[model samples]
Target: MDKQRENLTAADKKSEEIIEDKRAVQIADPSKNSVAGKDTELAASQVGYQDLFDNMPNGCVYYKVLLDEAEDPVDLVYIKVNSAYGRNIGRSLSELIGKRVTAVFQELTGEGFPCMETYLNVALLGEPVNFTQYFDQQDKWYSISAYSPQPGYVVEISEDITEQTKAEGERRERERQVALIERVASLGALAAGVAHEINQPLQALKIMADSMIYWYDKGKETSVEKVIESCRKISVQAGYITSIVEWMQDSVNKAWSDAPEEVDVKKMIQRVLILVQERLRAHGIQLRENSCDNSLMVWGDSRRLEEIVIIILVNAIDSFVCVDQGAREIRITTSCVEERAVIEISNNGPAIPDDIIGKIFEPFFSSSKSGTKLGMGLAIVKSVVNAHNGTIQVFSSNQQVTFRIEFPQYRQSV
Candidate 1:
């Protein structure tokens, strides 16, 4: 019995040795141990990537391209989405994943969502695109960037920009309000010139009416032709007066509201000159309109353009306060240069000091010696020009100060 126990123990030892040899082989072969380690590391790496995707602040989505019978992408299938994506769309992952985009947002079907075309291009072409979209259903704006990560798969990252868009809109509205205020101020400054322009016609009308009244009251003989001519003159004067009042009213009412249109530069300049002519004469300043092209045209609000001309003209007029009236001259020229309409208004007044020229367009910066002006005129002028996609420059030399303005020439589309 003892011999039998010893043999059994030896057999058990041999079996244990065989198991240890197998374990040693497994450790010595990289294919077994290293492969297991590699698989564990790969699983950990995938988990880490998933964690990062879920934690991203911006909404992230992975989409699989859905193709029509023609092999053109028609819609997208949500393959995967991060937590922020669910928060952005107000949907859970269970509701979004494996769902078609059209089914998720039914209103986006057909041509309603133009962004689908951009997405399709990105997915099929493996390109990247960025765009901003406003969703009426959500009442929000999103700035989205999308790129294809692989064939038939695209990744999109989106940020909510609704607040930013609203802020920008509010900023624009405030600017418009400020511009309106400046326009009113400009009109106030030109009130005297406008009144003078209206008065000339009023005086002519008075004379014509008085002549007709005197002929009838004094028993003076007059031909029917003479009476008819007097009536015609009276009508003409009345029309002129009406024109002036209407022009002023239009300027005040549509300073900031009117849509851009083709404006005749020469006709506009001529009309402005009519209003300021009396003032120029009063100051003994010679107004010279040189090289004004009748066909010169620009695209802008005529009232605002008129305001620009008037402001610069007023500034030029004020520059002559200390200047010798006999030597004062204001020259206006309009021409086309390099597909641009150029207006040059120069005055032979005191030159703008070198230190002040740069700040002329700044709000509340005035070069006037009297210091009574609000100094918003040139600032408003700069704003108006910029709003119209135009430019204005000033140069002064040899007792001559010139305001050079350029606007893109209006081209009628064929």
Candidate 2:
């Protein structure tokens, strides 16, 4: 028994010596030790990364790109996916892992697999891509970010943005409603001017018809030339009345459109002047217009551009209510400078208060004491101008208030 115990002790000592020699070699050979340490660290890092990826709030997917004969990436093979990814896509790990992307998104074949080109570029070219996509099958919107993890491999992260998209759409709809209401209110304020405009042509038609009937009833011989002249005059007045009514109807009923066209600034100003001229004359406000003889063109909706002029003109007309009628003057000028179309509308009515000028374009901000105005006209004007990539500024000094608007000059593409 003593001999066996000695042998056992010798064996144990031999093993201990062997272990110590290996430790000494590792310490002496720093490179070997470093390599071994790096391997351990790499393994630990991979495990940690896997844990983080699986636990990320956003969905994450890993794919291995499959190439064709031309070395062009043709399809992606699902290698790994986090729980969040499966949840977001409404699929199980069993359904995705070890499966081709085409098999999983067979329904999207009609659309050529959404972002297939984008994904392949990321995997093969190492170019990262970020984009938003709407998944019809899932009825959701997602913001996806994809980048190459290594050659021929990509990792994608996705965040659901359906609610955000819906909210933005709803907000735009609400703005459109508010803008429509403001336009109707503006037309209401111009009702008197519009009535006067229609009445003048109507009164002419009545006078011409009355003369013709009087000639016929008095037993006076009516010459063919006189009858033709009266008919021509009546036709002109009727056409004029039709044009005014048509313009008003279009203004009230036109829907907002995104398509833009080249708008002649001079013609637009003339049309708006026709609508407001009677109002200006009724208020004894003198109008001075200095427009370029050459056509000044801008790229935007004609109706919205017309609205901008009308809003400014109406504000100018209202400004005269507190001033003596004889001193009221409004000036409008259009010019082109530095590849920009510039419009300046100035009024000599009481200058906008220094404190209120800055806030005039803000929605629902009014300086009027009547409490009947919602003050959305200038706000809508600013919004429309910005939508057209234009700038508007106000200057008030020396008993004058001027609104200067600038838009990029329309240039025909070559």
Candidate 3:
């Protein structure tokens, strides 16, 4: 019994000695057991975080806010940006890190753009901002989400929406074209003028034929010179009819081509005026022009540009006829500004209400209650201007309105 107790004590001592030896080893090299392993674990965690960041579907940009003397966020430096963010900015990821936001996108820092202010708000106030914005220069749409993860730091996530926006625009354009055709079909006033114009040329041709028949009936000696002259007159009148018919056919067909060429601005305007002048006169609307040099040119489709002018003129004429209160007058002026050609069409008619002015260029937007109204004319005009890399704006006040269109002047490549 005493020998068994002694053996149990020795076993207990052996277990204690083993534990003590392990404790000593840990004390001698603590890093191998805890600190070193912890470092390895931390490194693996960092690599995971980096991998997650790099593979994120949406564009991600991390910014460190630079503050003013008042501790207000004045600017932001790109601390880190993912590959998607670099592509969205049309730059390399290596080129963007450490760059300032102002240096990266100068337009955003300007007064008209709200991106800089929105970012600053998130950074300084720790507020989250989520919105969709169209970047005109980039010609893209982005669904942006920004939030401050820490003081003076902001993270922005962006998803590209360009394809979605383009799809919507294409759908709207198709609807607008259909509505335009329906509206034109309903315009009896314009239809009557077109018919009258077509008939005049036909009537003249008939009169010349009748004169030839009379000469033959009386057996009068027809000189070859006179016959040739009569034939020439008939040809001219027939050509006029053909031109008017072709114009109507093309307008109704709505065939648009992407091929662009050097277009004489003055000649295009004259062609449009020829189409609309009679209609304007029938409506008692006087047209006046403060001419610019005919030498000014633009790079675009002449037919499309003429269509834009026609839409604006028709809209103006309709307003004049609708209001029927003031002197129905449209004044046109053209000039060159820097590298752009500017055309201004002003009318002394009913002023467009301030509330709806911004909506005028939107598809299917119209304030007029006329049955013939399509509300797509100005929208088409805006689309055409954008296609030509041009800009259009409206100013209205005191029963007067002006549409100003500016196009990049076409210069021949040397």
Task: Identify the candidate with maximal lDDT.
Answer: 2
Candidate 1, residues 72-124, lDDT tens digits: the string is 88999999999988987789999999988877776333334457788989988
Count residue pairs with overlapping backbones in model 2.
0
Q: lDDT at 29 for candidate 1? A: 82
Model 1 alpha-carbon drift over 4 Å, by segment:
1-48, 67-74, 106-128, 148-151, 258-264, 274-286, 292-299, 314-329, 335-342, 347-379, 382-414
Give the candidate number with the greatest TM-score. Answer: 2
- Model 1 C-alpha lDDT versus the unseen true structure: 0.85
Better of 1 and 3 by lDDT: 1
Give the 10-residue window scoring lowest on summed lDDT in candidate 3: 182-191
What TM-score does prediction 3 earn?
A: 0.46
Candidate 3's C-alpha runs over 4 A off are 1-241, 250-256, 322-326
lDDT of 3 by residue, 1-414 (tens): 999899999999999999999889999989768987899999999999999999888899999999889977778899999988887777888788998888777644343434889988887688898999988777889999999999889999999999998999999888677646543543332354457666766778899999999999999989999999999998987776777678877655544334578998888888878776656766788799987764789998776777778778877877775656446889989889998999999998888888999999987777877655556667778877987899999999987899999999998989
Candidate 2 clashes between residue pairs 3 or more apart in a chain or in different chains? none
lDDT of 1 at 83: 91
lDDT of 1 at 322: 80
Question: Which residue pairs show backbone clashes in model 3?
Answer: none
Question: Each model's TM-score?
Answer: 0.71, 0.76, 0.46
Tell me the spans in candidate 2 whose CA falls farther than 4 Å from its real position: 1-20, 65-75, 106-128, 147-154, 220-230, 256-264, 277-286, 292-300, 314-329, 336-341, 347-401, 406-414
Give the count of colliding residue pairs in each prediction: 0, 0, 0
lDDT of 1 at 6: 100
